[model samples]
Target: MDKRLIVVLVVFLFVLWYALRTAQIPPASIQASAEVFYINNETVTIVEKDGWGLFTLEVKPRISGFTFEIEFPEGTEYLIKVNGKEYRGNTTFKTTIDKDSEIYINFRLPDEDTKKLYRGEGQYYLTIKASKLPIWYVEYKIKLIPRKEKD
Candidate 1:
């Protein structure tokens, strides 16, 4: 075989191998349970059913806050608890299930003075209690990346 042809073939094979290796699905950090579906390394959705109907809970971490999206049967009631405290404040919002019913909980990096008290990066737990549905719970891992300062 010609030298140039051989070189091109080898390069093409390496590229193909790299693509296949990286395209593989990431192993689930949390195994699938009775009601929880581990979507990926950073997302999980919980599905439960009761007399009221089907309900779903999706949890994902964002740069500054955590996105808590949920879908419950109409007229159903639910409560959210963050780190053991009831989250019944302005940060929570109510919307229809057909729409993107998302509740964003904003958090900030602890400043130098308050770093010891509220060290920003770590895992946070959330417990959601829904009417006529099994209690849904999840732990969200958060990592804070510093923003680049623009000149």
Candidate 2:
């Protein structure tokens, strides 16, 4: 190759390297304050049900991965739309209490998906859309390690 051509190629390579290096993802975010949800009363059930402990919601998931809990006024109803799809779990339970006697309708998915609440294993972005508006959007970037038993 000619000397001038070699210099131009080196400059192009340097520029390309710089651009790629700067194309990094923003820094990880801070874990916000305890998550509480306020949903339109029309669609959420924030009440106690059956004989369950604080029925409304419960997800103290097993497997040390991640825990997400949401507390809202009683009489709140929510649909579990995980990653834009419906999931099968206690997430469909109804809240039968009023705000005056309010308790949390919490949902916990332990270990990302130790039990496969919604999506498969590994990192995930869980979103909660209340009523007709997009409310309480959350992302849980977690690693789902397999559970083991020790004898």
Candidate 3:
């Protein structure tokens, strides 16, 4: 089996896991029993951030006949937040693991961007506008924790 292909499969699975979580017990309710958000005819799983450390989440959906890209909108600005504040994106994170062993990328975003966070937990949020032309789904993941107190 191709190594790269395997990696992609693993990451896809992880993204799928995170994406489904929102549908399983989403905070808001949807009219359709199987369908949730409509993004380019895809289901985006979104969840509130709760904790820290190697937080991996999946963004792709595992449903059939679904069509959409996990990538964010074209003109949207993305920033990772940790514990309610802007995170230094310089923190090194690799997509290779996300593509292989990880179900989601172990990327650490700042949590200070959100104040409604739960203690001992972290939250990450993605801000973007909905595409009016083709109904689209937005799958967002959140992870929060203190900056690894610089050594």
Candidate 4:
């Protein structure tokens, strides 16, 4: 065997090993459910009108994408937060649902711009707080879907 060929093979194997070891695997789909609670005031126990939901994921270090699908009543006002930070994307996070809409929001995993963003091998939280729901409603749900990185 040629000496140069052996050296090239060894380097290739090392690179492959490193890539495999550092690659991030996308998480599975998650469904989060939430229920309303009560607040005790001085005079009475008030039922909280707001609905809350939480979706948590331990993201790995990688440049991936995610989709959050949320459904609620037409008149509901909602807010979404990621790792305690408010998501400011207007297209993804709608503050109010004036009309009926099928919401689909996309975000990057292991965010590269901000270290504090959802871009590390740690537990990340995605929370939703909605208000002005129908009086009969008492539960809320949110779904998280992982998407593969495009080539």
lDDT of 4 by residue, 87-135 (tens): 5332235343332223323333232222322233232223343333121
The lowest-lDDT stretch of 10 consecutive residues in candidate 1 is 46-55
Candidate 1's C-alpha runs over 4 A off are 1-34, 37-62, 87-151
Q: Output the lDDT of residue 135, model 1.
A: 23
lDDT at 8, model 1: 98
- Give lDDT tens digits, candidate 3, residues 1-151: 6999999999999988767554432221112212124445443333335323333333332222332222321222234332233433333321211111113222323344322343444333332211111233343332222332347
- RMSD per prediction, one decimal? 17.9, 15.9, 18.4, 20.3
Q: Which whole-number lDDT from 0 to 100 does residue 87 have in model 3?
A: 31
Supply every candidate's count of residue pairs whose N, Cα or C atoms clash at under 3 angstroms.
Answer: 0, 12, 28, 2
Number of the candidate with higher TM-score, 1 or 4: 4
**Could you tell me which residue pairs clash in candidate 4?**
110-119, 111-119
Task: Compute each candidate's TM-score over C-alphas.
Answer: 0.23, 0.20, 0.22, 0.25
Candidate 2 per-residue lDDT, tens place, 1-151, comes to 6999999999999998777555532122222222323334222221212211122222322222232333322332334432233333443332221112222323343332434422233332223221211122233222212223358
What clash pairs does model 1 have? Answer: none
Q: Pick the candidate with the highest TM-score.
A: 4
What is the RMSD, in Å, between candidate 2 and the native fold over all Cα?
15.9
Ranking by lDDT: 4, 3, 1, 2
What 10-residue stretch in candidate 3 is worst by lDDT? 93-102
Task: Output the TM-score of candidate 2.
Answer: 0.20
